[model samples]
Target: MPIELKMPALSPTMEEGTLAKWLVKEGDSVSSGDLLAEIETDKATMEFEAVDEGVITKLLVAEGTDGVKVGTVIAVIAGEDDDSASAPKTAPAAPKAEVAAPPPPAAAPVASTPAPAPATASGDERIKASPLARRIAAERAVDLSQISGSGPNGRIVKQDVEAAIGGASAAPAAPPAASAPQAAPAPKPAPVAAIETDIPHEVVKLSNMRKTIARRLTESKQQVPHIYLTVDVRLDALLKLRSELNASLESRGVKLSVNDMLVKALALSLIQVPKCNVSFAGDTMLQYSRADISVAVSVPTGLITPIVKGADSKTLSVISTEISELAGRAKEGKLQPHEYQGGTASISNMGMMGIKQFEAVINPPQGMILAIGAGEKRPYIVDDALAIATVMSATGSFDHRAIDGADGAELMKVFKELVEKPLGLVA
Candidate 1:
């Protein structure tokens, strides 16, 4: 008997993926734990491993095929005792899976009369249209029954509804009667001509990672109620402390970055003001026990947050080294799901980019994100006297549903104190 190899979900949130490449061809011998194929999910490209030893019998899905649904059979394998020669060499018949499909012909039955009425099938029977197509039809005032379906089993789809609307708009209108006093027909507006220029441009298709980023960010803004709080903190002490510590640790190959110190300070503050370290669970609030910090790293694909687990417990050198390695792997798209998935809080430092200050969107399941800005010399009041000092602005974006404004302010207060004092971070 031939064993079917289905497309595996590379991540928990992965519903579909591209069958980027196949490692083995038909009749190739494979063993358990063998590399089977490269599956490209929305987040990363992961290798698929074989669990059972077998010979390649058939490739059900081809390489470069995108939007292959999870659980869809991608290949077939013959057991060691089974004869590979007897198994099928070609791919089995399957539905075409594409990231974007062309609009099919209208499937709804077309009514001869042009009156605005709901489209229906013959003898007032209901039309067979997809839910999306039905919604589009309602929006466009299209009659689904009059349009022909181009989908499977004569089902109406989005394209079919759109095509029907286009056809209706393009149809010739009836002429006015000669006996009636006719008003002058309004002049048709001229179509705008395309702007001609020598500027070179190219259309690049959106990658899965880019698509996921857009979707998740959109959801974050729309679903989460964000409250932003900004505070300016003097960073001279923290910078001086970092410089002195780096000098002492240079022999041990440990150099601490200001961002690393900030991560520790944030973790400690979250522990001090535990209310800020919570996730909004709709009917409940989930207060986290440990401060796992998700550090946002901008990769070529998009923004990814690789977490530094238990930041409060880890030493400054350890946090710095871990972040360096995690960031490098994240940029290369080599991070595992667990390495980037969950965290109690997040830190997005744009200070390196010279950004002064900006509000950040809350990554869901996490209550707040600390946005760090550039440290620059600015006028400040110290001991009732104004003086120039090195200062940085930190903004905390909190989920108002889970964390109170007072608690968020307290967290910011503690974070500022830790950075300004400098010793609390090391102690």
Candidate 2:
């Protein structure tokens, strides 16, 4: 019997995912746990591992095709040695599977004649419009060729149409329509001022991750009462330790970064404050024994948060290595959902970008998120004497509904202790 490869649920909030790429093509032999397709969920691009040993008979969902709901048939695998030459080729042709695939995009409308265009000033000349404008006009049922162009290329601009249709520059408006319905209707107003314009914009569809982020963040802001607690930690010793460690390990290929140390410190802090390592269920908060910290990475499409599992148990070196790998993959959009999700908490660090401090939205299910800032030289009063010190400010955004202000304060204190004394984190 053949088995279906349904779109795996990548994140708790993922409803559908994009088929980013397929590691195994049709007819390729696959084994249980074998790497299959690379799926792009709402958060990250992740590997879709096979669960059954068989041959990839067909791919119902092709690469770049998206909006596949969770558990929908993404591919089909035939039993060992079974020929799959007759399997369906496209999603539309696939037999009924567990989860239903979305209907195909509607066909383009056929025109009886070539699309009508605005009359250009030149005889028999067609309107000069940007490609995007042309497409937008088609979609909005606007007659682009009819509008006059004010652009350098004599192209029809959005404002041009608005101007043609009673913009500020439009001729003096005629009397009210009710009063002058019989008289010639007033000419459309043109823009009064020379309105500055930009190149027509393009509308790119949102990726799964962006859509989910928008939806979840919007909901979090609307539903979760968020409270922020901030603390500036003096990182003189940590920076000095990191420099020494990097110098010693230069040959061993283990140079450490402030962000890496921060990740390690956050992990250790979680151990002391396990309450911070929890997710809010409807009535109660569920805590986890292990500390997995998801670090946010920015990509071309949007942000991806890849988790460093067992972070508390891992040494600084291990954490650094895993974090580098995960970050690289995140930029390439190659992370698996598990690699990005399943974290008890998250860290959004913008220190490298010279950000002094910032707050981050809480990635759902998780009760806490730490926003990191850049290290800077500042004056500090030590023992009544003012001295310059390098300190990095960090803010923890807690779900007030789950974590109390005192608890948040305690967690920040623990984090300060571990990071200020870098040895504690490594030891």
Candidate 3:
């Protein structure tokens, strides 16, 4: 019996996918777990593997085709030596021969294969259509190559077409003759070029992921009574600790970043201020006993937040290891839906991207999101004297319906102390 090769669900929310390319042709023998095609979903480009070993007998969809729903049969594989199960045999010699040959000479041009003609429309029957013309035609839904030219050598020149469409030509002036040179005289005042005003034009279709982002963000902003609290932390000690940790862990293939430390800090702070870690549920608020911190990781397709569950209970080293694996899997689109969704609190770090400070939108169901910015060297009062220090800014967005401004500020105080002191986090 022939086996159907259906489009596998790359991610939980992925419904339809685009078949980017096929690795094997029809009739090629394939093994189970072999890469068969590359599929593009709303999240990432993933390699779809063949689940059954057999000869590829049919391909229902071509490459670059989109809107193929998940579980749709895309291809078929026939069992070995089963003539009845195999695809109907068809002669492929003629198409192969045509593909193998070099194009014919221009003297005897074939009508089947169209060649580009000159662009100038002289008195001849030909029309001159430039490559730009052909591109414009494809974009504007015009058939330039198909149109019969009224100009020289079947050329569809710009002016002739404009005239045919009842439009005037803003023809360019010809350059001066190269054979005759003019003498240099007094310089004339050069006219300033008119600046083109930027027209506010925006009508592109929204991508599936973008549409989801829009809907979720709108709901979050409208329903959640948002209040923001900002705090500045000294990062000199934290930076030293990270360097020492990374130096020791380098040989073990574990890289500990400041963001990793922040994850731990947030988790520890959440444990102290349990109220800040709660999420609002309709008329009631639910406070989680365990701290699940969702760290936002940017993938090629879009942003995804993967959770590190029970982060408050786990040591910093464990958080580092788990986050590394989670980020790696997230980039490859190997993360399960549950692995990314359903966190008690979240963190969005733009510090690495050179962002000084920025606010973040709340993820649905989560009452708070911490926005972190880059550290910069500045003068600060030390022992009643000004001294150089490294400081970083952080903003906490809390749901007013669940958390108050004073309560959020208190939580920030604990988080700030944990990050600035650095040694206390381990202690």
Candidate 4:
């Protein structure tokens, strides 16, 4: 049998991706784990590998094809012993009888559900559930093993898990079902007004990265209740410490940036005020023990946050080196999924760009993000007298649903203290 190679979901949030390039062509012999293609997701370009030894029969999707949906057949691979000439040249269509099969068969019995459950429930074995279905199951604590698949070849899918959940909930003491009155239909939204222009302009299509960014940020602003807290922190002491450390560390080729110090300070601050280092999960709050800071780096495509894991415990030099490497790879779109996926908190520094204070949208799951502005010479109170000092406005955007105003303030206070003190970050 010829096996169909579908577009793999490179990331958890990936629904579709561009077929950037094909490394193998029809009639090419390949072994398991051989590089098959390069797929460009919303975040980065990832290499897809062959799962079975086979001879490529046909390429269904051409290179550079955008928005190829996940699970859409991209190519066909015939078995090692199979003749390539006899392999299917296209995706095999289902028979009319199979297409006409009724939905009642899927709901037949709970025993049928177990047929697909073994693939996922076999201890420590990889599950063959769809990404969305897996996420839904995780969030609902519904065991994947108990659900029967209704998708292709007994593959567990979203509808199957949902149906299983509904069945289970209904199994508990059946309530007298009453037909509730249907609410009035919602009114259609007003169409967006088109912009009038006399000058000729090009209609540039948005890239996958830009589209994902737009969608995620819009959702963050709309769904997350954000509370912004700004504080002016004197950076003179931190700057002095950085210079001194750089001079001493010059022999080792290690130079620390202010952003590196900021990452450390934020991590320690989160450690001091654990309430601020949290994620807003519906009906629950996730309090993290380690402070992993996602530092925002602007790539050509868009912005990406590569995380600095355990920043609180790492030395400033280590944080500086790791961030440098991560940011470089991030800009090149070479970061792996794990490098930019999850973080306890985030820090977005536009200080180097010389931007003044500006509020940032909160990244979902993360409760807070520290936005750092340029440090400029300004009037400061020293011993009750006005003096010159380098001051920078740092704003902390918090998810009000997850972090209280007081806790957010406390985290900011601690951050300022660590930065001004300049020794706690290194110690």
Candidate 5:
């Protein structure tokens, strides 16, 4: 029997994805850990791997194919002794651990030839490990047998493997490097009564990311009731601290950015005012214990938010390093799903772009998103007298359903104090 290759759910919310490109073709011999294809989802382009070894008998979907539903058969593989020509044509039962909608019949559990163990240190005994974990463990010369796994059924995942090595180097998952999200572009209109333009314009097709962004933002505005709170923040103390810290840390190759400090501040503020760090689930509200700040990084395809998990707990240098790494990977479309999936709140900084102020749309399910504006010299009262201070506008857009206006204001107040006092950030 030909082994069916169904699209695996790469993400919790991913229902379908674009078959961006195939890494293997018909008659190609594959191993359990080999990369088979690069699947492009709304979030990122992730490489798919084969779990079972075989000769690729057929490719059912073409490269660049879009809307391939999860659990849909995209290819076929024949085992070493199977007759490919006589393989029965049938609907594929989902693979092991596959989460299929209207799941396969319980009585007829899909039987399969066991895949060769992927663990690099396997002998008579085999350790179950993901291809990524196996690869990482091999590179690091770490023994999989010594480390227990945290993944499903004691299967080792990346995080588990990394923990076995020097754990501090492993960055915690935060929300993506995003705070202020660029408003999702307006949706494409219906075909009827379409306007024809004489002015020259190219019809740029929207990628999965753009389409998802549009649909999601449209839904956020229409569904989530948002309350906006803006606060003008003094930057002199924070700027002074940043410069001193950067100079002292120069020998260690560590530098902190204003945005990095702000990420920390926002996270600390969320911890202080837990009332604002909540998501509205129908009939229930989820209040996060720690803040996972998503900072937006712009990529060629679109924007992606690679999280820095516990921003408040991490040092400014650590936060800066993680953001740099996450943002770089995000641009390259190399981030794993876990890096950007969930967050307690978000922060989008437009300060570098010189934008004075703007309200950022809430990334749904996350209660609030903080929009940061450029800091500039502004007239203000200092020491009970007229003075000029470098100030930036920080706006918190809260989901009204989950958080009250007063709670949102308190969060904003705390965020401002952290920035102005500045020492609190390092402490």
Candidate 6:
């Protein structure tokens, strides 16, 4: 029997992905765990491995095809004993099994075109519109029958519905029935209409990573009630300790960074102030036993947070090594889902970019994110006398729903104390 290779869900939230490239072509013999295709998910471009050993019979989804839905059969594999020549040759030709949904067309640049005539018997005839357009039409009370579609096969997309709402006379929709089994979901913001301009510019489609980042950050700002607390921490002691530790470990090639120590400090502080290390699960809060810190690493596609599991319990050298490796892989778009997914808290250090201070948007579910700024020599009180000390401004953005203002402040205070004392990080 021929084996069907369907699109695997790369991430928990992934419903679809781009078939970036095929590592194996049709007619290639594959074994279990062999590389199949590189799928570009919302977070990263990860390689999919073959689970069943067989000969590649047909590649249903071509390379560069975007929006391939999960569970959609992307390929057909023949058993080792079966003849490869007996399998289907062309993609359009159906295999032995039935395929419900075909793969989407290869990615292409989007261009707006004037739609055809509007105002037809939408009641009798079936309406051809995208799901997003239908949703927007329902919310804005825009009659689809009065609007012309501009998408493939004259299908109405979000832009079409938005245009109708803007120019077409739309009557107000009646309120949803209260006796309905479930309430209507919150209306998502409509796509922004393109503006006419004379400025020379090129339109680039947003990558999955960029799109996800935009959507998530917007949701965070809109939904999460944030409480920000800032504190200046002296880094002189921590820097001194880092230097001494690096000198002793020079032969082993394990050098410590200020950010590495700070990672440790933040994890330790989370352990001490357990209230801040929590996730907001509506109507309840989840407090973590150990701190898993998500360190923000900027990749070419977008920003990703690779976690250091149990940073509070790991040694500074171990944390430094692990961070370096994780960051390298993150930039290469090779990080697995688990490596970048969940964390008790997050830390974003823009110190290398010379950013003085900036409030980071809290990643959803997690209670808070610590923003680290550049450390510079500044005047500070030393033994009741003013003296120059290396100091940095750290800000904590807490989800007011899960973590109280006092808890966030205490986390910051403890973080500051750990950094100033320096030895507590190792202890």
Model 2: ten consecutive residues of lowest lDDT: 169-178
The alpha-carbon lDDT assigned to residue 405 of candidate 1 equals 93
Q: Write the per-residue lDDT of candidate 5 for residues 146-247, one digit (tens) a residue.
A: 765543234565655655563333222222212212122234434347569999989887899998887778778887898999999999999999999999
Q: TM-score for model 5? A: 0.81
- Candidate 1, poorest ten consecutive residues by summed lDDT: 172-181
lDDT of 4 by residue, 1-427 (tens): 7877766655534566888999998889986556888899888887776656789888877788786766666788889777677776445443222222342222213222223343655552355566667777889998887775544345566555665665453321111011100121123334448888989998777778888788778767777799999999999999999999999989989999999999999999999999998776666666777888899999988999988888888999999999999999998888766567667789999988899798999877678999999999999997799999999999999999989999999999999999999998878
Taking all chains together, each candidate's TM-score versus the true structure is 0.74, 0.66, 0.63, 0.77, 0.81, 0.77
Model 4, 125: alpha-carbon shift in Å? 16
Ordered by TM-score, highest first, the candidates read 5, 4, 6, 1, 2, 3
- Give me the displacement of residue 163 in model 5, in angstroms: 14
Return the lDDT, model 4, position 99: 23
- Residue pairs with backbone overlap in model 4: 113-148
Q: Point out where model 1 deviates above 4 Å.
A: 89-91, 94-200
CA deviation > 4 Å runs, candidate 4: 89-198
Assess each prediction's global lDDT (C-alpha) against the native. Answer: 0.76, 0.70, 0.68, 0.76, 0.77, 0.77
Instruction: List RMSD in Å for every model shown.
Output: 18.6, 23.1, 24.4, 9.9, 7.0, 16.5
Give one digit per residue, the lDDT tens place, for model 3 in 17-136: 778899999879986446788887665566765544678887777888766665455776776755634343332233333323453332211221222444434532343453433444
Which residue segments of model 5 deviate by more than 4 Å? 87-195
**Candidate 2's residue-wise lDDT over 49-80, tens digit each?**
55456787777766887776655667778777
Best by TM-score: 5
- Which candidate number has the best lDDT? 5
Off by over 4 Å in 3: 79-215, 243-255, 281-286, 321-339, 381-387
Model 6 clash pairs? none
List, residue by residue over 267-365, the lDDT tens digit for candidate 1.
999999999988776565667778889999998878899888889888999999999999998888777665666678999999999999999998876
